[model samples]
Target: MNKTVFITGASSGIGRAAAQLFLQQGWNVAATMRTPDKEKVLTGANLKLLQLDVTDSNSIEAAIREAIVHFGQIDVLINNAGYGSVGIFEAFTPEQIHRQFDTNVFGLMNVTAQMLPHFRKNKRGTIINVASIGGKVTFPLYSLYHSSKWAVEGFSESLHYELRNLGIKVKIVEPGVIKTDFYSRSQDMINDENLEEYQHYLKTVFNNTQSSGTNGESPEVVAKAIYKAATDGSKKLRYPVGSPANWLLPLRKLLPESWFFAIVRSNVEKGL
Candidate 1:
């Protein structure tokens, strides 16, 4: 029997790529998104396009149940539904902050909670979280986005220890700057007319960020890394994808904290 992988945010980018990759490898894919009706690319045998909004518990439950009913079981759960909330921290409203955490942090936990009983009963499963290199290292104008991803990184790390005893695995896939719709459709920008002081700074940093994605790897690269984490069968935890992440994660660890921050500040703030 082939395994099944349930993925969120499968309408585009890494999630869509992963769904296609898994289906190619003979796995059933529950490719879920808020607007499944709009997705047209991924289709074929063993593919189930589902409607799932991670921020809504009822939607999450319905999608999971439907996938299990259709495919019998889901061997892997990929938490990939999230967006970036970028700009000056001061520009963000309380509601925006809540929405960011709702979709990125609590929303991830919501899906995981819904799937845990199924995974526990099976005694074998994998949870691959699609985090960002920003989780480990931060840049300018993405404080809220970084907060959510950083939460994901820590949560996955701590959960791995407990899940191991249940014969389940938890993994993190950190992509540096994949060429995806992240800056366009998959991101939200803070807008506060009162915060004119930060507009120029935000524009500079946002431009630098866009340049990184323009030169970054394709979404398929991170999709492949996610696939490896699911099938590697090892206790490995973090799988960093893309160029700068491959170098930056290690560099951040090797260099002093202040020095690393300085380098990041220079690159992002000064566009160096």
Candidate 2:
């Protein structure tokens, strides 16, 4: 029997790419997004679209129930529905902070928690949490986004040990700067009434983000990594995709704290 894969954020970018790739591999795909109908790439009798929003429990629950009803058993899940919260840390109000976590950290867990019963019953499944290189290293003006990804990394790691005996696996995909709508979709909080004082750092960070977003690898690169994690049946904990992401893993470990910070500060903050 062909395995069924459920993916979030299927309307665009990496999630969209993954859906296409899995479909090509002859796997059953449950592609969910805020607007699934907008996806022109998803086709075939095996494709099912679920209207899903990770931050909305009701939406997520409905999607899960639908998946269970249709596919009977979900073999893999790609938690990819999230946007970047970019700006100075001081500029992020409590509401803004909550919004960041609500979508990125808590939202991912919410979906995973809802699906665990399904995974546990079968004693087999893969949860591909879309974390980032930011999870491992800090970047200026991305405190909220990076912190959320860091939480994901930690969450996925601990879950691996907890579920391994159950024959389920949890993996993290630490993608580097992929050429996607990630930057264009960031919620900027630089000059909100609550955080007007952090304009200097915010400007520098925003500029850096714009430049980097344009130069990153295609979203397909990360999607391929996610596909591998979903099907490779490896015991490895994390997979870093893309050059910048793979490079960061060692750099963060080998570089001196002061030196690394200096480089980050100069490249990411000095001009601001």
Residue lDDT tens for model 1, 1-272: 99999999999899999999999999999999999989879998899999999989999999999999999998999999899998888888899999999999999999999999999999999999999998998888889999999999999999999999999999999998888889887788876767788777778888888787788789999999999999988999999999899899999999999999888888888743
TM-score of each: 0.97, 0.94
Q: Per-residue lDDT for 1-272 in model 2, tens only?
A: 88999999988888889999999899999999987767687788888999988889999999999988997889999999888877666656799899889999999999999999999999899999999998999887778888899999999999989999998988899999898878776444445545657666577677876787889999889989998998787888889998688777898899999988887777766576
Location of the lowest summed lDDT over 10 successive residues in candidate 1: 263-272
Model 1, residue 256: displacement in angstroms? Answer: 1.0
Judged by lDDT against the true structure, how good is candidate 2? 0.86
